[model samples]
Target: MDVQILFVDDALFMRRVIRTALNECGFENLLEAADGDEAIRIYRESRPGIVLLDITMPGKSGLDVLDEIMKIDPEAVVIMCSAIGQEKTIEQAVRKGASDYITKPFKSTNLAGIIKKYL
Candidate 1:
């Protein structure tokens, strides 16, 4: 399959917003997971090229999902996205092997556009 990006967020609105931004950037191979468990399942089945993960959620926060994803594939490209003032959580995510972190309210251009080059 072609390279793809998975947007993992508890908020459906945030997922749609992120998807729209990616689409505007000319990316069409996108996927979504409203919660961590579904994220893991999809990751296993599809093995998307990248993951845009939100930190806060109802259960199994993005951090936890990142850990699980890393366990499944150590080379997984996971970018943690969190609201401002959550430096500690972001730091922890980085320490756990997240490829990058972005603060919320970010433009799609802020999402490591060059990342597509690597994929």
Candidate 2:
């Protein structure tokens, strides 16, 4: 499919991993943002079909970005990424309008499955 997928994370490695995973699944239209600010900017311009966001970051946190993105596009399909034991933040992200949540150290295949279901 030609659906646009966006990855938002502060970690370069994590973003790279996500890219490779999506690539393996035959997804070629991928975008990336390293912080909440960049994520929001890219979201507006790219209007990606799905957004995979990291919960913690140096700048605007993912939760804030999620809220802002929802305001911009209520139907924005955002999936919050969290490390293990961050259930509280993940729950809050959901409440803030995240479409889904994925635990870190994820399998690319698993992420592709989620994207397929939503896309």
Candidate 3:
């Protein structure tokens, strides 16, 4: 099956940009959510092969979603995305269960390389 990925970001533009990059990089099954709560719901229902989550959001935070997912499945492969200078929060996310973290405004090749390593 095509590698499935669920991308969660509060910014619609960021989501679209990520979706486009993943699509162009051979990931055909991409799902997106605008917030962590929706991300949790989608993740529970779809159980995608991978997840790309943004750290800062309006509600329930990506870290919160990561916590929930880890509770449900310790083996879940999650990648945290954050802007520069959010080291503490990102580190907390890593401790919570994220397999990797990426910064915002990342190059498509960087994303593709990380995804390749994990998925």
* Candidate achieving the largest lDDT: 2
Which pairs, if any, clash in model 2?
Answer: none
Off by over 4 Å in 3: none
Compose the digit string of candidate 3's lDDT tens values, residues 1-119: 28889999999899999988888788888899999889999999999889999998997998899999898789999999999999999989988889999998898889999999985
lDDT of 2: 0.92
Question: Which pairs, if any, clash in model 3?
Answer: none
Ten-residue region with minimum lDDT total, candidate 1: 110-119
Q: What is the TM-score of each candidate against the true structure?
A: 0.93, 0.97, 0.96
> What global local distance difference test value does model 3 have?
0.91
The segments of candidate 2 whose C-alpha lies over 4 angstroms from its true place after superposition are none
Leading candidate by TM-score: 2
Ranking by lDDT: 2, 3, 1
- Weakest 10 consecutive residues, lDDT, candidate 2? 110-119
Local error of candidate 2 at residue 21 (angstroms): 0.5
Candidate 2 lDDT over 35-99, as tens digits, reads 99999999989899999999999879998899889999999999999999999999888888899
The local distance difference test score of each candidate is: 0.88, 0.92, 0.91
lDDT of 2 at 49: 94
